[model samples]
Target: MKISSRFTVAVHVLSLISLNKNVVSTSEWIAESVNTNPVVIRRVMGKLKKAGLLDIRRGLGGATLQRNLADITLLDVYKAVEVVEDGELFQMHENPNPNCPVGANIQDVLELILFRAQDAMEVVLKEITMEELVKVLSKKIG
Candidate 1:
């Protein structure tokens, strides 16, 4: 199964806040940019706030980054949004037939590989910070 959209949306929200530091990034305003409902933005914003990535204001005050963009990484956003449970990114089908050689051995062989894959991905994510991403975004928009 694919990872949830919440991760990307969180990144988008963070990027928007970084780019438009002067603008009040209300849930509705962020929703407009993401082409989604304000409720979705609010929900994602709530998670981001809980993760200490964002500081959401009460009422109409809107939201802002809690930490510098340079301090945030894609992995930070990934975990913040809870796209997948810790160490459970690639889930295997439950109850492989013990009688079958392939079924019995599949999980054993695949688990380590999947974990390594996930770890590798996290490594890449950790290397790239939000500030780096925003720089790419800025170049693209110009």
Candidate 2:
């Protein structure tokens, strides 16, 4: 029921890139900012690149955004690194008690609720762009 931290890390990496748009973002520097290993940052960067959210260069080079911050959304980042099965953002428990009416019915009810919740979440995430995040961070740092 837990989402991987890859999504957050990807966002953090992208944010760093956005903030330092004039300069290439090295994995080492991004890793330092994320408090993670360079290898981890590289892995997430691969995903972002594949998603067309980033442009990565070879050795001695670094990463950059493929598009403006306003063009990217958290859901785009989520889809890039999320490893969920069946493409579901949420999962339901397996094997609800068939004999129990409540247990049997609960799964269906939960599915509907969880689906709606995920939809609502994506809607909000869609509303938020990387531009908004960078602005917020810039204000805090300055």
Candidate 3:
């Protein structure tokens, strides 16, 4: 299953936003790091801003972290990027062979498994913070 780009960008965005020291970061730079469209970055930033994880300024301005990275979990970033808590993460294929009994029931079983997996993943994500990720990334990049 493919995690959305929203999750990727939000993680990076939160990490960089956490690095500022009495300074704001431009969306352009954020987008550049993301290697994506500025419009897309702005849209994601808007959601993060609304979630109180970030602060945005208008007119040649930039964004700043409104909350501490330690206080912002990966799950929080996922939420900011609009990743629903539903079982869609598994992306169960719709066309299970209807002829077989197991096939008839596979969807239900898969959905239940997906839900549980999602829950487990959410817990795991909550255990890590943007600050921790930034530290790891810094070490790796350094």
Candidate 4:
């Protein structure tokens, strides 16, 4: 399954906010930093807002981080922006050949593997916080 960049962009948006803790971050500014369109930033920001991760004032104002960076996890950002059917991170091929033995068992095997992979990913994501991200960014700039 192809993962969307919206998850990364969402993290970028939050990290920018965390980096500039003293100032409200406009979508345009964030978009410029992320090298994307402001509209795209706003759309992702909207999802984060809905997820209670951010606060965006209407028109002429900017966005603010609602929670401490240390309190937010990558998995939280993933959930905020990922639009998945049935909230699945991994997807199995649809309509595997029922006539073939490998095809018949492929999905079952895939499901077990995918479930473990998804769980592992979530565990890693949950272990990471935005605070850790900011420290890494600081190292890069300095």
TM-score, cand. 1: 0.90
Tens-digit lDDT track for model 4 on 1-142? 5678899899989988888867769998899999999999999999999999999988867899899999999988888886554567776679989999999889888888888988898899999999898899889989
lDDT head-to-head 2 vs 3, winner: 2
lDDT of 3: 0.82
**TM values, all candidates:** 0.90, 0.84, 0.78, 0.85
**True-structure lDDT of candidate 2:** 0.86
* Residue clash pairs of candidate 1: none
- Residues 1-142, candidate 3: write the lDDT tens digits: 4677888888888777776555557888888878988888899999999989988889868988888778999888887787764436666778888999988899998888878988898899999998899999989978
Clashes of 3: 0
Best candidate, lDDT: 1
Worst lDDT run of 10 residues, candidate 2, spans 82-91
In order, candidate lDDTs are: 0.92, 0.86, 0.82, 0.88
Error of 3 at 136 (Å): 1.3
Q: Any residue pairs clashing in model 2, and if so which?
A: none
Error of 3 at 35 (Å): 1.8
TM-score computed on alpha carbons, candidate 4: 0.85
Model 2 stretches astray by more than 4 angstroms: 83-87, 97-106
Put down candidate 1 lDDT per residue, 1-142, tens digits, no spaces: 6889998999999999899988899988999999999999999999999999999889667898999999999999999999888758887999999999999999989998998999999999999999999999999999
